[model samples]
Target: MLAILYVSHGSRVAEGVRQANHFLKQCMDQINVPIQQICYLELVRPDIQEGISRCIKHGADCVIVQPILLLSAGHDKRDIPDEIEKARAVYPNVRFIYGRPFGVDDSIIDILVERIHEKHSGSVQNDSILIVGRGSSDLETPRAFSRICAMLAKRGISPVSVCYMAAAKPLLKEGLELAVEQGPGKVYIVPYLLFSGILMRTIRKSIETSVNRFSFVLCKPLGYHPSLIHLLRKRIRESIDYDRLSAQS
Candidate 1:
C-alpha cells in the first residue's frame, strides 16, 4: 500500500486548515488507490511528523509527499524535502517519494480561464484583471504570477499586472489603483489563493471600499477543483517514475 502526504504552507488562519483538509478528502475519495493519511507541515494540527507516523501505522509500504504549493521555492524545493528526509529515517522500511510543486501547468491555466469566464461571462468588457497572490520573497513567486498573466492573455484578457498581498509590490490596493489609471470600466481582482480565509475577506473589503469600487469585481479562491487533483496526481506519478529510473541507473 502507498501513503500520500499532502503538505501545505502552514497558516495561522483556521480556515486555511479546513480548506486543505476539504480538498484532500475530495481528491482522496476520487483516487483509485487509497490515501493512508494526510497531514500539514506547520501552523495547524497534525503536523508532518504526526502524519508520517499515521501512514506507517496504516500499512503504507511506500510514501509519496505531495506539496500543495504552486511553485518550487523555499518550502517546495527545500523545507519539505528536508522534512521528508527526517520522516524517511523514522520509517526506515518506507520508501518515500517527493513530488513537484504545481507550477505553470496547463490544467491550472484551464481552471483560471474557467474562473475568469464564470465571473465575467456577461460583462468581460476587456476589463483589466489584477491577479493577487500571497507574495513570497522567493523569486519563483512573482514568476508564477507572471505565468498566470500569460495564461490569461491566451484567453483574450491580459491582466493589467500581478501583485502581492503581503510581500511584493504593488500591494493589492496599489494594483487596483493601477488598473483604475489604465482606464478600464471594470477591473477584476482575482485571488490566486487556494482557500477563503481572513485575508481573502480583507481583500474583498479592500476592493469594496477602494476609490475605484465601481469598476472592481471580486472572484473566489481556487477550491476543490478537479484540475488541481489532476495536477497533483501527475506530479506524484512523475516522482515515482523518476525514482524508478534512478534505481535502474
Candidate 2:
C-alpha cells in the first residue's frame, strides 16, 4: 500500500482542521487505492512526523509527501523539504517522495475560470475580478497571483487585479479601491483561500456592508476537486516510479 501525506499550510483556527479533514476524506473516496495516512504540517494535530509514522506502521513501502499549498514559497521550498528529509531518515526502508505544489496547473486554472464565470456570468465586462490571496512577504508568493493575472489577461478578461490580505502592500480594500478607480462597472472579489473561517467571514462582511453596485461573490475554495486529486496522484506516482527506476539502475 502507498501512503499519501497531504501537507497543508496549517492554521491555528479550528476551521482549518475541519477543512483539511473534509478534503482528506473526499480524497479518500475519490482514490480507491489503499492510503496509509493523511497529515498536516503545523498548528494542528497529526503533524507531518506523526503522519509519516502512521504510514510506516501501516506498511507503506513508499510514502508521497504532497504539499497542499498553492505556490512554491518558503513553506513549499524550504520547510516542507526539510520535514520530508527528516521523515526519510526515520523511515529508512520506505522510499520517501516529495510532491510539487499546485502551481499554474491546469486544474488551478480551471478553478479560477470557473470562479470568474460563476461570479460574473451574465455581466462580465462591467465587473472587475480581484484575485486575493493570503499575502506573503516572500517574493515567490506574489508571483503566483501574477501568473493568475496573466492567465486572466490571456483569456481577455479585463479590469482584473491581484492583491493580498496581509504581509503585502495594497490589501483587499486597497485593491478594491483600485478596481473602482479603474472604472470597472462592477467589482467581484474572489478569496484565494483554501478554506472558510474568521478571515473569510470578515472579508465577506466587509464587501457586503460598504460596497454598492459591486457584486462580490465568494466562490468556494478548492474543495476535494478531482483535478487536485489528480495533481496529487501524479506527483506521488512520479516520485514512486522514479525511485523504482533509480533502484533498478
| Best candidate according to TM-score | 1
Off by over 4 Å in 1: 10-16, 122-125
Model 1 lDDT tens row, 156-217:
77654787888778887888888877765687777887878877888988887987788888
Q: Candidate 2's residue-wise lDDT over 1-249, tens digit each?
A: 677777876777887777777776776676545764667777776888988888878888877788888777778888888988887787777887787877777677777777777766775776677777888789987777787788777777766788778888788778766767766376767777777766777678767776552545556655446677777666666766777787799
How does each model score on TM-score?
A: 0.89, 0.86
Cα error, residue 122 of model 1, in Å, equals 4.9
Q: Mark the regions of model 2 whose C-alpha exceeds 4 Å error after superposition.
A: 12-15, 208-218
Residue 93 CA error for candidate 1 (Å)?
4.4
- Model 2 poorest 10 in a row by lDDT: 213-222
Q: Name the 10 consecutive residues with the lowest summed lDDT in model 1.
A: 30-39
